[model samples]
Target: MGVVIPLEENKNKHASVKPLVDLTKPGMERVNQLILSKAGSDVQMIPEVANHLISSGGKRLRPMLTLASAALFDYQGDADVKLATSVEFMHTATLLHDDVVDESDLRRGKSTARMIWGNQASVLVGDFLLGQAFRMMVDVGSLEALDVLSTAATVIAEGEVLQLSVAKNMETTEDDYLQVIRAKTAALFAAAAEVGPIVAKADKAGRNALKSYGMNLGLAFQLVDDALDYGGKSADLGKNTGDDFREGKITLPVILSYRRGTPAERAFWREAIEGGKSDDAQLEKAMGLITKYSGLSDTIARAVHYGEMARDALAPLPESDWKAALMEVIDFCIERAN
Candidate 1:
């Protein structure tokens, strides 16, 4: 079982009540229905898996951005809802494949698709979702939107492969890590926000503004996610702490910790991370070294820096509730413990 913690003790306690766009609002409801319809009837078991994943619940941050961006432009049509669902399908597909690729057993506090259904089934179902997303795109009839989503999917796939290759590759630099993040996580976020303007038929400048907003937000979000694995609880984060290191994935905290440690400390990390499998004593020693070297503080600082960048990206947007909400979301990206 995963570690359990009280929700009331979460780091961002106040954020739990933060305002969000009512996803059940009439237009948003239409979007949810259309998303299910567009997902299509796959082989019986496959569609069931997709549905299970969808219903498992996430913050739906990407689709929420799409809806907020569309509302900002006063989009009257309900096509925005369908488009939002399309973005979600694409996001979900990536998650399914990501679990398989990483050999992950847990996601959102539940057994991962790969753990429950086997790797082959999980991967094949992921492909089915990707195809369904494209069909939804075709229905939208926006060639520009189709192009953007397709390119994002390709980049995300490449990014996943690159991260896998760099696993336990001690020479991996911060720049290399950021590049992987941009491709794997930010590209889709950029596309998610960019689609809103296209659907609303906003002009070039307006569309670019939304794209920038999503890009920076995604960067901040992923950095914090990486940092939390080392410093957070399973009940709060929906996954086990140290799973990244246990799986031989060297993330920002580990990288910085090794870089700042003594030569002997660094060598120990190389054995623990690169050579794989750290005994309890070694893991405890590594955690102490990381704390002494201040790598955890550095990682958190980096997340805050990017969070500021995400907020600044929204300066181009006018003053509105949605704009303020977007800023709050950026803060939540870094401040959230879960």
Candidate 2:
């Protein structure tokens, strides 16, 4: 049987994200306005699809990081708002493209753009968002910030291709999975945090510190997400619990479980994952095997390791409310698994 934890304990664990959300509210309001303004277009379908995803409820964590990191140095300019909006646009564009690439039906607990508008419109709108993001970046007139975010865009694309190459390959290693998440998820996070100090004219050390914190925090966040796919509720995930299994996506839990299972168990995984027999019964069997091999617990342990690295990244920065809030974000990302 899967090890069960108390429901109230899990609820308490996820409460850490709330404070960061509350703290970033004022700056996030400006970011939201810019997001809405930029999402509008002369073409009806363009705004239709873009607004659909934008209106969907996400925590806006990336832009919040941009805002909070700027606040850490007490930046006086309004460029942070524009830059934060750009960061959010980049994120939204990625989600639109990812849903199409994954052929997913749902995202953020709503039907995906592709599901409602078709793949052509979804891809085109995603491209439009990327263009808008770059326009805003150029308006900021910071070549360094532009360079960092643009480079991240390239890395994210490469990461998507890498994940495609490894999809459903049972031999995929833990190292390989780490590279994919670093590029696809953590690269944007590093760039988002790094740009804040650049815009604020903070020293190189401060810039690197936030970047390190974001990178490690992102790794931890995705690791917890991997564990939650097996152990969490759909309400918490904003998608079906077994979506990863149905997609035959190789995640950390699957990697650990596959590596540790017996010959017969490995054979079952091959049939279920590689062979794409991921129906409800197969999903149940997969969960049982994952529980038996302690996959969920091991993945959470990995997340905790990265979370500690994130906390250590902030050790050198002078203490401030922004720094404290960012630290809490690390806790929130890991505790979501509880």
Candidate 3:
């Protein structure tokens, strides 16, 4: 939950995401309480760690997506709250594991779970959270819920493996990159959005609309994430600006830069990605090439493309404020810092 990007940086880097709250609504307050209650508990050590991360304060995007999707279908069940929490729990579990895997030191401006707790504890507690998410789904009592979560979990694992396998490989293609995004980042988002309608037993068209919305929004979010990693405040991004280079992770901007660069620039990228150590000088040179190629702009366009697709995906749903809120969330994905 890295949270130290200065307000100036966020404002300078881009515009703020439009606010979506309809403060007059009762469901919104209930949803917030539900999220808080679901994250509450008595397991001192694990829950403490969980609470530390949860309270570090993200925008609570996943749970919001779940609630919004349910609202689109006019669902009034208490199960939506539980399901939203379940989605957040699953998302948090992935973040814990990801921090350990990435050897990440900071998240949202706070120490990573792996940095605070031992690796073993982090892994085990993450597993515990994952199980709790599943238990919550079971309590929701929908087979569709089980199917969506199980599939999302499987894809997340696959994405992790895919990323690991291709790490530092200069030849990683755009299609391959999208595959990894779909697996790692988008899977849970898709599930979070789709499950609401599924639980409410919405018709096929509505379910598909929500699923498409989540999938596109997730892709857009990850694209922006990769772009920001190269050209963002380290405090805002939670990871170092050149971390992808340091860790040998080949993201879209880097790949595109490599493709568009001069012979020396291409060689530099090859060496950097393939076990070359980069100091500030080399990092600056690499960033210069990325800028020359307008890689950031290209990445933003891609993100915008997905954002539009996400918005278009909502066409089948009946018009409602919740659907509008979901659209705003997608806008936030492309525009948010930290």
Candidate 4:
């Protein structure tokens, strides 16, 4: 059976999401209603699987960015709500597909939809969500918004393929890993934030600022998640710790540890990571090596660097509560390490 990590325990740690959540409450309420309405279908199974994951515990950060970005420009129309819903559907679809590709048993401390309903169902429902997302995008009638989101979808698919190419390969470079996350994780963030300004008809500078903020924020977010897999509690991570190690998936910490370790240490990594010799004992040894080499700390440092970049991206934007809330988000992302 998969482990269940209760989210309530981490409430204090995740307060960064609170301000944005409160600020976007009205907009998000509309997005939530649309999400449920659009998720329904005659097929029954489609909504079953889609709602299973949708109702599961996720912060819905991407969609909030869309809502908040539009709110920044004081957008009064309902377009932002639809766009926010679209961003969420895109994110949910990606999660379903990702669990299948990773063969993961747990997500947000619950059995994955694939594990419960099977891979075929998960994939098909993910496709359904993607379709619904595009329909919403088209309904908004912004060619530029549609183009940005469609481009992000293409980039996300390419990023998934890129990750598969590098999986279990210890020699994956930092540059290669960065490229993968930039596309797979950050692309939607960029699009979600950029679409806000687009819908509000903001100038190019405003659009570009939000784009930069989302992209850098996403990089920081993923980097911290990678670090958490090695050092965090199951409750904090929403999955068992060392799942990455057991999966033989090479993340930044493993790459750093492998690159910096001694000859015998490198062999150990090769045996454990590439050779798939992961076990409880091997995981313990792996943790030792990671700690000895400061892999986790270094990864956090890199996250801090990107967090700073995200902060800088917002420097030119006029001050507002939404902007302050976004800035707090950057601090929250980096502070999750504590």
Candidate 5:
């Protein structure tokens, strides 16, 4: 299973998510209740499928961001809870849909919902979660928050499609891959962080700050995952190591390795990735190529760059346990994985 973020690698014991978890715990309790309530359905299989993934080992960091973002402004209301629940449902829905699309067998070290329930069921449950997410948003009665999340929903779909467009294509550039991640992974993070300030009626600058912070954090988080796919073990990712290669995902490491490779190495990538023939030996070779070309290290460097951007984005926000906790998140995302 993927080691949870804030793993044992944290040398900066001070740099932990404990503060964020503690700060959001009270609010998160309510978010959990909303998640359980909304995930229910008269049809038994719906709840079963939903619960399978929902109870999996995810940290629910996105919704925590919503709670902490609101806490940053000291807003005392329940709307943020509903919004947080919405964010989680959106996240869960995407995971279900993603497993189906990627044909992934494992998630969080458990059998994927698609693996157990079948793709049709996973897709249907994901759609149901999206519907429930919109309902929760409507309950919050914030049009701007609604717009942000709704746009995220649309953008995430676009990102999935964009990823599919570029999948296994060695020609995919860094920009194309970055755009896909911005939409698929970062869009919800941006939405989850922005909605807190919106519901709290914070200043425009604060909302923008959180949004930018989340966007950069999301980028950093995914880049680390990209590097981990090649550089780390299965325990680090929860899924099998080199699943990206098996799935033919043209992530940053692949892009970098492809671009920096010799003509023969490039042909190997074409045969292994674009042609979809990667096996254990080829995966090892690919890892070596990524290392030989500094793809893994450079990917981590990009993650660090974005991590810095995420911290800088929060610099103007009022200092509080909330802000400091959020700052720690930037490092935890990098250090825990690296």
Candidate 6:
């Protein structure tokens, strides 16, 4: 319960993605319609599983980034809608597959699809979503966009594999953790933002700017998620506290705590994390070690670093409400860890 990080202390005002939501609402409606239509399958259970997760509360931030980036340039085409939906499908597919891999029972504070229908069903439905995502990418008819997203999809899978390879591995370093997230999370965000400029026919510099913005924003978003897991309200977490510990996943905080702790403390972490003994008591002990070592605060500090990078990424782009909204997204991410 130690939250010593002043993540947004320098900011005088709260940052809200409300402006982004308002800006993208109209486009999001189209994206939502397409999501439902495309999520459908005559197989009945397919839509059931897909819609169950889709309708569950997710910010749809990736898709909105696509829409907002495109709108920033005033692109007048329906292709961005398709691209946005494709971005969402990619994200949804990853979640379904991740739950199966993590053996997670709850997501967004509800029963995971795998929990209800079983793992085999969840994996197949995830594959279904992936197929649909590529189909939409093709329909969008932009090879550049297709290339960007497809490469991201490949990288995401690679990131997941890397994470799996490192599970319960206390030796996992900060750089190793970041590499996994860069591929698993940031790649899609980068692609989602980059393609908007590609489709809008904006210059390469603008595309690069959005891509950089997105990649950094995604990193900031996930680092905060890592911090929140150890020191955030359950409502913000969307899953039970200590799920990461229970799952034995190595995160930055754990890395810092283990590296900085006393020898006996290290032994405790190795037993709980490396030896799979993460009961409630162990969880409390682990959190204590993380706090004593400044793990939570340092993790938030890392998130703040990336949040600054995300903000600076947009500096070269011309100013607009879309740009302002995107900036708010960076702060909103860090402030959540406050």
Please say which candidate is ahead in lDDT: 3 or 4: 4
**Candidate 4, residues 1-338: lDDT per residue as tens digits?**
12112343223345477899999998889999999999999998999999999998888999999999988888789999999999999999999999999889999888999998999999999999999999999999999999999999999999999999998888899999999999999999999999999999999999999999999999989998888888888888888899999988889989999999999999999999889999999998998888888888888888878877988999888999999899888878777777
Candidate 2 off by > 4 Å: 1-15
Give the clashing residue pairs of candidate 5, or none: 1-238, 2-237, 2-238
Q: Which of the two, 4 or 5, has more lDDT?
A: 5
What does the lDDT read for residue 147 in candidate 4?
98
Q: Higher-TM-score candidate among 3 and 6?
A: 6
lDDT of 3: 0.79
**Candidate 1 per-residue C-alpha lDDT over 1-338 given as tens digits, one digit per residue, 9 for 90 to 100:** 11122343223445421454553266566767876776557368787778767877677888888888777677777667777888898899999998887889888898998887888888888888888888878888889888988999999989999998898887888888888999999999999888888888888887888888888888877877777777777776778877787788878878888888789888888899899867667766767776777666676677667766766677877898767777777767766634
Cα miss at 317, model 1 (Å)? 1.7
Q: Give Cα-based local distance difference scores for all models.
A: 0.78, 0.89, 0.79, 0.89, 0.90, 0.92
The weakest ten consecutive residues by lDDT in model 4 span 1-10
Q: How many Å off is the CA of 115 in candidate 1?
A: 1.5
- Tens digit of lDDT per residue, candidate 2, span 76-152? 88889988998999999999999988999989899999999999999999999999999999999999999999999
Clashes of each: 0, 0, 7, 0, 3, 0
* Candidate 3 vs. true structure, TM-score: 0.90
Better candidate by lDDT, 2 or 3: 2
With a 3 Å backbone cut-off (N, CA, C), the pairs that clash in candidate 2 are none
The true-versus-predicted C-alpha distance at residue 154 of model 3, in Å, is 0.7
TM-score of 1: 0.91
RMSD of each: 3.9, 2.4, 4.4, 4.4, 2.9, 1.1
**In terms of lDDT, which candidate is stronger, 3 or 5?**
5
- TM per candidate comes to 0.91, 0.96, 0.90, 0.95, 0.96, 0.98
Report the lDDT tens digits of candidate 3 across residue range 1-338. 22233343232344333345452145556765665666566777877778778778676777777877887887878788778888888888888888888888888888888888878878877887788788888988999888998899999999999999988888889999999999999988899899989877899999989999999999989998988887888767776788777778878989899888889888898888886667778788888888889777787778878888998999767777677667677766777534
Candidate 6: tens digits of C-alpha lDDT, residues 1-338: 84655634536257788999999999999999999999998999999999999999999999999999998888999999999999999999999999999999889989999999999999999999999999999999999999999999999999999999999998899999999999999999999999999999998888989999999999988988988889987787888889999999999999999999888998998999889999999999998888888999888888888888988889887889899999999888888776
Candidate 5 residues 50-93, lDDT tens each?
A: 99999997999999999999888888989999999999999999
lDDT agreement of model 4 with the native = 0.89
* Candidate 6 minimal-lDDT segment of 10 residues: 4-13
